[model samples]
Target: MHASSRRQTNCCRKPSTSGAKAPDLGNYAMSLTAALNTALMGLSTIQAQTGVTSGNIANAQNPNYTRKMVQLTTPAVGGDPMAAVVAAIVRAAAPNLLQDYYGATADYSRLSATTDQARQLAEALGIDDTGGGQTPLQSRLTSFEDAVKRLEATPEDTTLKALVVQRGQELAKEVNRLASQRTTLQSQTQDDIRTGLDTLGDATKAIAGLNAKIIGQKAAGMPTGDLEDLRDAEVAKIAGLVGVRTITAENGAMSIYTDAGVQLVGTTAQSFSYDSTTGTIRNTNGDNVTAGFSEGSLRASLDYLDGSAGALTSSDGNVGAMEKFFNQLNSMARNIADVVNAAYGSNLFNYTAGDAAATLAIDGAFTADPNTLDATRMGAVQQAMRNTTLTATQINPAGEPNGLSTANVNIFGLVSGVMAYHARQVSDNEAARDSAENLQANVEQKFRNLTGVNVDDELAQLTVLQNNYAALAQVMNAIREMFDEVISIGR
Candidate 1:
């Protein structure tokens, strides 16, 4: 055969080792690259997960920090089957639990404010001092009664007359001091209302600003977990100041309103103005509207200062309980002065016409000369002290008798009744505060269980991430060695 014919025959002849497989270097390189990419992706996911777990562990003690979880999702990349990406970082917060916590906090704050004011009133009234065994007012009243009885037994004792006058002055002083304390409380409440308004304004504005930021971030496909958490915290704070309701829109915008349906924040924050002089809550448009606050520190202060719930006298259509208490004290002072002046034919006590409690004093004639306190009219004095038929018109111009029209009551009895009523109010408020605190604790615990970080759980998650990272690294090392082997073979 010719040389060309022999070469053709050799090319067409079958190989001796038919079982041996030939390596496809192009396909092997592609497969190795794809595998390396997939392993790198897995390592990246583990890194992200480890960062998240580390963050959780670091913020375990932070009350404001919510636990973060990274969600994994497989991408549509054609190269690798196991490659994944981070889809989102989720904050472990339950909206229902958050709302419940806000409500409980508001109730607790309201009760706390009310109880604090009541305790202050009790202290001022000298009724809460157990160390003295008896209140100063009670002691003075008892001493005056004793002196009057002794004067009745021995009408000739000028020294007993002086003692009776001294005791009467002491009783008047106590009443004046209590009334003054009430006035101070009213002033303090006014300051608190102003402070609350300022706080509300600041918080609402902050919420509105945050709403804008959140909306922007959501539109830009940015993570808003931290901003949302901050906004929620601010909302909770506002709820504690004034019971509020929140509405979240689809665009991540949030609106806030009072429980009474008064808008506080929306696209723009609404401004509030408080008129301490009129005890009115008004909007920026200058319209006076009822606050109608149910549970909050502001609501509690307003209730104690001017609310209609616990008034002693509902006359004249006025509702502030503290104001009514003060008015009742003034009326009692006026009644005592008028009756004593009528019985002794001398002005034993002097007081202003409208504000008798604030200005009650022992007359100079009675204080300087004990004889001016005549014991001859003991019967008339006793009758005046026990007078129950004293007309409301004589005591207060706007006051009308409460309960029975012809009922009989002494000065001490009427005053004690009002004091006891307020004391009961204080006790009830304290009980309510305690109940709310317990409920708050339970709700807080429930919330923490659902959203709080557990060290053991986090550690377990970290271990899993570590193992994944190690496995992915090994796969990467294998891919690198395979690439080197393929290069050596090519050389």
Candidate 2:
């Protein structure tokens, strides 16, 4: 009844050149076999389609899994096709959308690091942004000035003299504590970089190893969708640690590189190292990439060590929040010491000339005996506090400490400026971080819309495949019945 069977029957019915038409058992047998093979081809195609649909449904929740589909093909005996057969499996995804998502992820990580560090600094300095009280440094400065004024009014009060020394000790202790905090934060930053490098090394090695496996699987004509999934997940992980670009070859080997063109993975994986002494991150080639990092957690770490705005650094030739904070503290400490010591001449406060901030302390002579306090110098101390402004270069244990602007500010004003500088940093970096988070979310959603699996769609396809499989089975059974009737007729 089919076209191929009809064609065979019509050919078999043709008149013989010798004159009489004889029964052609061979042609009938071939027709039945041809019908059976056609049904088998349809059945095989249905099986492949079902498998692909099942895989899609199974991976519906997996973001990295790419959807797979069977490409249908047909075989022809002479001119027309017999039945459709699955040619090969292919994966579906938008490569450009995926790359954009990865880019956003890297940017978000960089800004988040910058913002979080600013908040950490604000907390450590006791400078509250949410209408909280003044920084301990600011309050201590006020208390010290008040004690000096009280002592100035009562030249012979031993209790007043002792109070001035007490307040001065508190103020000096606060400066030393803040300067020490910078050193502690520096050590912590180095440790974070070391941990990041370790994670980066592991990701690169895993990606490179996956690349080799993918190449082999693809060459063997196997479905490499799962392997590709693993590789993509690995890439996404390190994308936050450093900004990177990836290119996948036809053979399935993926090459990764920094956005700045530093090759991270080629035929083999690249390794990164962290130097605790210099607080620098280096690639396997020993290049100093700390200041060069444009977008990532590593970039944020560099900013934490310095600052982003018109921040002053110790000697690294870069400016950031921590750098500005450290330099400003040291400058203020030495300036205060120089003026107070010059005016009183009895060394009211003691500090090492090189590192004044870490060594600032109240003179033990005054604390030991309040009677030794020079009430005559109290007026000089007031004049020193009121008239003196930190407007010149000062000692820096690390490097040159650029003093306050030539605006002629008192000690309290200098301390206030440092707080204002950090507040601005927190505001700017937080805004940038919020913008990056929005961009990352938008890009990620776009990627998911384009390539993410749909369970309902796959389930519908599975239902259609089941119906088709049943139809093919019925067609094969009919062909078997026709073959039996012909065999009985031949006997």
User: How do all models score by TM-score?
Assistant: 0.87, 0.85
Q: Give the alpha carbon lDDT tens digit for every residue of 436-490 in model 2.
A: 9999999988777767777888898999999999999999999999888888888
Identify the leading candidate in terms of TM-score. 1
The regions of model 2 sitting more than 4 angstroms off are: 1-26, 129-131, 285-293, 306-320, 338-346, 353-357, 379-406
Global lDDT of model 1 = 0.76
lDDT of 1 by residue, 64-87 (tens): 778888988987665534778888
Error of 1 at 289 (Å): 3.9
lDDT at position 18, candidate 1: 75
Task: List clashing residue pairs in candidate 2.
Answer: 306-320, 307-319, 307-320, 307-321, 308-320
Error of 2 at 465 (Å): 2.3
Clash count (model 2, backbone only): 5
Candidate 1 Cα RMSD after full superposition onto the native fold (Å): 4.2
